[model samples]
Target: MTTAPHAETFHSDGTPDASGRRVGVLLSHGFTGSPASIVPWGRYLAEQGYAVAVPRLPGHGTTWQDMTTTRYDDYYAEIEREFDALRARTDVVVVGGLSMGGCLVLQLAERRADQVAGVVLVNPAVNSTNKQLLLLPVMKHLVKAFPGIGSDIKKEGVVESAYDKTPLKPLASMVAAWKQVRAGLGEVTAPVLLFRSAEDHVVDPSSARIILDGIASADVTERVLAESYHVATLDNDAPQIFAESAEFVARVTSQVAAS
Candidate 1:
């Protein structure tokens, strides 16, 4: 399948910090959205001398039909692969993502608590209140997909490279995976930095609430994005996301070194 423009994976090996301990950040994009959505954020982290890895999930960055052939595990395996590689190269690693990607990293935080130093999320989605989704199991058998939820950016002229449709099978797989992620949330003890948009059409507020309530992290912080939508990483408040995440990485990595 031909990949969409700007949808390729992005990676950078950064310089070591002042303490000579290298820090890495692994970022993931949203469902149906490609690395194009978060590569700018990854670039900003790399500029701050932090190793960065942004992997393209399976069945994504291509036609929506291709997504139907893959499941949630397929996407997450790609994330885990890049994450392990980053961890091998750096002294400590921080994981973050947008929407579904955010949920994936949360899974990593829960399952690999001993390895993950910190967690960052932007409009992460674990649960949805959409009534139509209740029939996903049956609907997925009857229909192949629905309209796409890409490019929910508030900024004018900014377009995210994403699929034009939402594949039902993959969506169902993701929703099913959410149950496991939620069940394991309390296992995540690393510091967390969560960013939620005040207005997001694709993901409702229930996800943010669930994450905040379920995670056991004592140093959890939630910030509200007033000017952006679901795809905040590519929206008007992108500069803030980049700068704050850089600061967050430094603070969390320093804490790791101190211990």
Candidate 2:
């Protein structure tokens, strides 16, 4: 029932870029996870003088039981609100996420193509080949949850501070929303930078394949995180994620500003 420290929402208005343009980045955490997982990444970007917003999804950051009270729409609605707020203050915005957060930002790119300057995804999950997930609709009614998918970091001392249980109802909703997100992937025209861990335990390679194959963006880059796991943003390769994403943001935003 208690929220973890650093699980709260984080935002910054940021200083203007070299172009005197105020650019922004919005990051969403994954299902059953909170902003605590990605705040460091956001902070890294904010320090680069880019406005940043990291919103805690509705059902997360509290307890698994609390997550049962919400659905995927609740989470996406919060992302939409934060995206709109960032857009209000910045000339252009680049959206990114980890896991389900990645899927949520992809939805943003689909619906607001003109507004999203670029997309950065870390271990984004869109589809799963897991046979157990197929039983979610029936299993959710019979049971409350399964084991948690938290703290899949390859680093020994690092823990994700995420929920210990994966609420079935919310998980099912996320799966359903994936269909919707996949349907609109072709609408996502913004350049995409995706990072997949070579040794991930939470999300598998299928999700990445679906995303790369479905999106319409011609400018897509995929990098393999050789040393990290699912939570690469907080794993051993975090520095790589932060530095490269900063470069990705710079390249895309400048292109958008020029055009």
Candidate 3:
């Protein structure tokens, strides 16, 4: 009667059923994205004997309308719920995300404390006032007036969704959420492993340095994805991301075990 964890198509990205494994990594995807985006990474982890949960937020993986129907709090709340589930099923957690998802994971670390063993951020969104996104409200209203590039996310090797059309209201809500998350960096206590692409066209690269300085974690390490772009998850350097992230998780899990 029991099913394998992650067996469901819609992964909650929270905790897993505690049948055997004790370690878990919860993955949160970026804004305007879905569990499908992060599923590859989670599947890789799952093969390594780790329970991986990739949570799809309210609006994601559905339609632009769904995204508009969601709020920033709604998005963060899903992450919170999933992280708590992971906490219940595992002894330690290494929480991570890409872009906006990365910001949410950090918020979880700050808010949840040691319950989160470590943090991993891949091109995380830190600040909210960047020029391209300053006119988000307008973009939402007139997305068709100017259907922007889907994803210029150039990694050395991977190609992600390059959708031309965009829904505006969702982005506005995300911008508001990003502002809230940026204001909350001080609360993160878990150690961090940050990966930033040198040529990320979407998020500002400089923000990583600011995060490295601002977070409260006692230890922080960074990796530069020189061959990647904004959506590293689907970039050519994705393998590197998978490999490096795996090592990071192993290292942190070991640290907690020793202590």
Give the winner by lDDT. Answer: 1
Prediction 2 global C-alpha lDDT: 0.94
Q: Give one digit per residue, the lDDT tens place, for model 1 in 51-130.
A: 99999999988889988999999989999999999989999999999999999999999999999999999999999999
Which residue runs of candidate 2 sit more than 4 Å off their true CA positions? Answer: none
Candidate order (lDDT): 1, 2, 3
Cα misplacement distance, residue 200 of candidate 2 (Å): 0.9
Candidate 3 matches the true fold with a TM-score of: 0.84
- Screening candidate 3 with a backbone cut-off below 3 angstroms (N, C-alpha, C), the clashing residue pairs are 14-82, 15-85, 15-86, 110-187, 110-188, 140-168, 157-236, 158-235, 158-236
Model 3 lDDT tens row, 1-259: 2222322223333333333337889998877666655778887777666767788777666545545666778888999998888777777789899888898888788788868888989889877446777887766676632353335466444444433445566667766676666677888877788989988777886679768877888888898887777888777678888888888887888788878
Residue 86 CA error for candidate 3 (Å)?
Answer: 1.7
Compared with the true structure, all predictions reach lDDT values of 0.94, 0.94, 0.73
Q: After the best TM-score superposition of candidate 3, give how far the Cα of residue 142 lies from its true spot, in angstroms.
A: 7.3
| 195: Cα error in model 1, Å | 0.4
Quote the lDDT for 94 in model 1: 97
Clash counts per candidate, in order, are 0, 0, 9
After superposition, candidate 1 runs with Cα above 4 Å error = none
